[model samples]
Target: MKRKLIAMLMAGVTAVTLTACGGSGETSTEGSAANAEGDKNYKIAVLMSHQTNAFTTAVSSGAKDKGTELGVTVDILDGKQDPNTQASQIETCIAQGYDAVLVEPISADAIVPAVKAANEAEMPVMTIVQQMKNQEDMAVSYCGGDESKAGKMQMEKAMEAIGGKGNIVVLYGPMGSDAQLSRKAGYDEVLKNYPDVKIAFEDTANWTTEEALSKMETWIQTGTQIDAVVAQNDSMALGALKACEDAGKDIPCFGLDAVDDALAAIKAGRLAGTVSQDAYGQGAIGVENMVKYLNGEEIEPFNYTECIWIDQSNVDEYIDK
Candidate 1:
């Protein structure tokens, strides 16, 4: 009987050992699944001011395509040209625990705090197109066309087209944007080289066709003989064209941002020329940089792409039919 009891006890011990081993195997499988989920999934957020324009749209498209290539899921949020909305979007990104954020701030100053918060969260933030005011303190990198250079180049081309002497009108964009400031600086620098070219009047168009048209109409009412109009962007250029037509003025107009409409205007001989920043290139590069950062690689603080001059001479190659 004792021998029988000893055998039963041995069997019980064997059963307990088998149970423990099975439990350990199940735990290992669960742990592996959790790890796999973490590796396969990553989230990135892109905050844009407005997608209505070609420039910002190109930026968004580039980010989307690049994010996909790197196996990251991207979320694009539009601020609708509202600074408050943009700030809220950044906060939302942080609350949702996004792995990284890419922002194109609408207002340079308003977005500073939100960007700081993102930085505080240890989230890598990238700015494109428009930069924040305190950029050095907040963003990891900036990727976009050099706006000041764009402005300077546009002015130089305008002066060249007009034989280096003209009474020019300046149509500026949003009042407090870094792009506008840089572009204006460029304009000022280029104008220094051509003393004969005088700025007759400067007006703010706010980067809209209607606003520019209204502003130009007011200038026309003053009876200023505008030899050429320099708009900060293509939309404003189109507006200037309308105003010129309304006032019966046949003057050469220049614009930056080679949008489809701008290219069309150039073909129609309504606009003298424009500078193309290759928004697609900006988007592609921003994405490339973001991916590198994600993979623990160092990135440049500023990446400036080359700009192209688009005029009737070479508009066919750039403009879409």
Candidate 2:
């Protein structure tokens, strides 16, 4: 039912409230593509990696809000986590003569040619969330969190929770994704300083709760002594937490992407902690920067928002603002 609702929202058939904006109660939907004046100054395309997840949905909302604020037309497109689909969308954007584009890349390598195509067409492209390979040479501006820093902070918090020594089961995102690789690098960097900390099991769950739950259940059945679970995203973290609860195990689980559920879990002492990337701000700022670029104003090459660690002690700061 939730997925059906999301699909409807994505299709611009209905409106939905966005999360990750605290409790300001601002509403946004995919249908709001025009400015308040009803005459758009520029037509921009906001291509998302996927619209199914809370993070990406909030991003889409942010882009829409910014577009409305700036009196421009912003069309939201879902990539469905496929590079080919995103490439095709870019081609469509080019053929339609979009004034600018904001891309949330799914694969760093696969997105290069598509971005290059946009460049050849003389269209401005800004990347949000995960960056593509050779980012400087491709996207004109970037607005998102530092994946490496987020991973480092998440691991450090988990390590601190587990007393710096334990067997951790790491839940990964898509195997070769930019977030997966860079976050793993950060985790490895942190593990280097703590020799007692070992990775007992690690695999990609594709950033989904169901897959993470299934994998964790199998790990439990195998009798692996998992001291903690570190998930790449909040959805997987919640799944891992559920699996542990079902198995009657008390495990400290950590995650990135401090979504609302994760924050509530932290408040209720179910989740250990998560890293905040300001998903909404990333989308809004990407559009804002793209507008600046289009208006012949100088903008920063890389615009990264703050990535902070959220735990029980500070979860209230992020919940229901």
Candidate 3:
């Protein structure tokens, strides 16, 4: 592990040294910024909150690929849905003296102090997909989907499937997570326009398929009239679909994060639709900019990526990719 971290730091620093001393478009943010920072090697540590789905795999792939393209070292850590684990990992990165760190925190609040510590130590920390709370002066930047917009898009499609007014079941992610909260806000905003639309059941599964399936099955057994399922992410939507299938019933389900399974479900006419946050781009671009900023370049504090809507009408164009 030590050898790998050394290699990453050296690789990144060597690349930056060349650009710092010779590049035309590049401007130094400080005097001898790359070299004078001591013989310390540059490295980027990425902490992912969880990796139970294809979305996180794609995100990790994108960041590592870009790191290789630019000769930077990328050290990745998995928090496994635990905020305490994530916070501990961030501290480890700081202790190791990494140049910069990237994080996909478990929630908006749990990972703040760890990030705050990194910033206090003068190591720049940034976030992807899941945002951090109280990120004013502590964290450096963010790159992810527009949570509210993604949620709004999913609810809109579900509403149409239910004929504008019906009882909708909402399967949210972990409570207090940035995506979970932001997307719910969007759902609330749109629901106001149609007063008759009601949220029949809303709960958090902590973002696991099994939990969602269990909750959905229990709901079905209760004989409650549910017109549609609106999930904050694709995993939950698929779980809801499984429950509906087991109960021998059909219900329209809308979800966010257009993973391969979601796309296939839509193609098979099982799901209503899903929103794509471009997991790959979120990781790739977030790290690319982090490297550039560390190399004395300017970058945006909040880099929200564009999202795409996918359904049966346009699922083919996105499935393979």
Candidate 4:
């Protein structure tokens, strides 16, 4: 039913209201591309969901570096966690006649009209980080982590550490965002195998550390008996950890996205585990595929990168000695 509504929203109307502040939004990255004649033939617009966090910054940085290396004039835009802003940015890109547009959507359903508009204008559109909910056919390529598998790995590791029987709280991203939805599906998939294990509380903090901290603090104040915390992303997980730390409650916590702090947290024994989203890899590969498309080379519909479940045994592999 939700899928049907989303499809209709994408196909029928371009108007959308995007309200969630998913994370600490950051400014867009500008490419340093200047041609010999000071005239760039290829102009691309890379739109990011936000840049306030490590994961998004790595992706934006990778994309900007690669775009400059490829001699393509890239104009990166930060959507500031607003779908309306993203739609407007895409509309602006189309009007500016960019050679291609890449979007990391704030919300898949809301961003559909923008992607569809790019298709209608005959401009190539690529997606990074997350796949759009409906009208995915309009995209030329997608470069990101395998969302389905990300949650499975996190839950699997968490189950191992928790012995498959404990009450846990889940901190999630924006409800409709690809990561939030896919990660929850993975959680359910694993939870089905453990009858005694229960998700005591689940909520969305909009993928922000501050919000997650507030949620965790409130949960603590209520005296919620939680054995573990399963956060959909590192930022939220860190916030959860912070709350637990403040209350002097040491509990196993797991997160995805393996952001910089996540690695540090794992090394310091603040977190139980994390799964990598490979932000840099995805960004670089997305730009590579964009260049290939412009060079008349065909690319696959899905270019999924791999993720690793990081824990104490292998935390050293990620964190510097």
Candidate 5:
């Protein structure tokens, strides 16, 4: 009887051991399959500053199109020009386990910590338009139009229209933005070549048409002889046009970003020209580069798209009427 009881105990132990081992093996196999499924599904997140602007809208559209083409599940988050919000969105993307992050930073410095966090989490971060101060280490790729070159080209067209000498009013955008700073640097460089061209009044319009209109109106009230207006963007240029019309001043105007309104203004001869920086291309390239990096391909640190000066002489050809 004692031997039979011992035999029964041994059998029970063997059955339990076998059951546990089989269950463990099944779990391990399922886990491997789950990991494989996760690998096959790519997730990408794109964070942009604002969508109200035409340029940003085009960029968003381009990113969506490219992401769809590449079979990526893209999550687009709009910061609405709020830097802190943008940073938070990046962190959320990281927490959500995105494969890659493509950002058009509202401010370079504000987004660094979030980008760093993503990097630490092993997520590839790509910057568009604006670059971080320590860009070499922070971003996998920096892709966009060269703001400085665009600004310089626009200024050159303005100078050409004004015979290289005039009293110029500069309508700038937000103070610390990379685009604004680079564009200003280019404007300054071009202005240096024309000593006779005096800056009548230079002020920030905050990249808004309303603000630009108010600022230009104030400048006009001050009795400044503004022969030409160099608006950092077409929206502000349109605002300046309103002010100029109100004041009965027919001074030539120049703007960046060949927006539809700007193109129309150019055709109407109200504005001289603008530099066409393809925002759509910027967005498309950002996603494309992220995809390439994921596929173990190297990407350029700096991807600069060319700019074209759009003026009355050639506006019709480029404008989609």
Candidate 6:
């Protein structure tokens, strides 16, 4: 065990040294910032894609709680679901000499340059919930759900509920975002098996309830039969559900991120079901991994939490967690 730990520490040191040597001659103090302050006193910056809904907020809450428990300072910066905002924030974290950074990216491709800059500065940037482009080269590690798997599970369940044959309206997240792309990939994979199920209408809601409501209202006006609503996230799911209810159109809705509201809706028999990805757990674990990396300890390149299916039959088992 001691030898293995030593090997891990040596590998980390070598990587940092090489990266730091290749950087512009200006000295970067981030490497020693945590050590100088002593263990458990390091500062970490958590860059969230956005806090527009409960899921992102829950992730930040968990990170903050873990930071407190670990006796480290954790600051969360909102990106407002804008790649530019996230990139700007990453620059600020680098300038502020933070010990580490955790990012929930707004766009996988758009966030690459910022991540590359962090890498050039020899600042460890870990991704949570969403991935940046070339994740293996850009970020130190990733901690989140398997978006494709989650999408697959969500679509499969929705198909099962609808008997695999119906017209469904798909509400998407921000296009080009990691979750949006990967989850949709999962959706498409399942869709290949259900030839009778057609996508009646689809559009991007940008992961907001209001946006989803507006989109659904517009789609409803088209007068096309929508049997089930499959949303990438719960906020959009609830919004789509609301539009159907207001229009007196009964439709079964499925969503990911089994948030509190979604869970309540399931128990109330308003929602069909949702896939539960532990947003809070993802945040907490990301912070934990950051600490390990900072301390020259071994950390997994990919840390994924389990995604569970929740409906009235199993909603009780997941209500509190």
- Model 2, 142-246: lDDT tens per residue? 899999999999998888888899799999998878899989888988999999988988999988999999999999898878899999999999999999999
Quantify how close model 1 is to the true structure by its C-alpha RMSD in Å: 17.4
Q: Candidate 1 residues 1-321, lDDT tens each?
A: 011122321222111011111012210001111111246445667777777677777666666555544455566677777889889878877887877788888889999998889889998899888788878778989998899899999998889877888799999888777788889999999999898888999978888889999988998899877889999998899899899998888878898988888888888888889998877667657766876777777899998877888898999888754
Better of 4 and 6 by lDDT: 6
Positional deviation of 265 in candidate 4, in angstroms? 1.1
Question: Candidate 2 regions off by >4 Å?
Answer: 1-40
lDDT of 4 at 261: 87
Give the per-residue lDDT digits (tens) of candidate 5, residues 9-106.
12221111111110122100011111112354366777877766777776766666555555555566777788887888777777767788888878
What ordering of candidates by TM-score runs from best to worst? 2, 6, 4, 3, 5, 1
* Candidate 3 per-residue lDDT over residues 15-50, each given as its tens digit: 222222111322111112333224433577777777
The lDDT for every candidate, in the order shown, is 0.76, 0.82, 0.78, 0.78, 0.75, 0.82
Q: Which has the greatest lDDT?
A: 6
Please give the lDDT score for candidate 4: 0.78
Q: In candidate 6, what are the lDDT values of residues 1-321, reduced to their tens digit?
A: 001122222223211111111123211112322332265577688888877788898887667666655556677777877789789888987887878899999988989898888889989999999988899877889999999999999999999989999899999999999999999999999999999999999999988999999999999999998899999999999999999999999899998998899999998999999987788888878987898898888888999988888899988877754
After superposition, the stretches of candidate 6 with alpha carbons farther than 4 Å from their true spots are 1-40
Q: What is the TM-score of each predicted model, taking all chains together?
A: 0.84, 0.88, 0.87, 0.87, 0.85, 0.87
Better of 1 and 4 by lDDT: 4
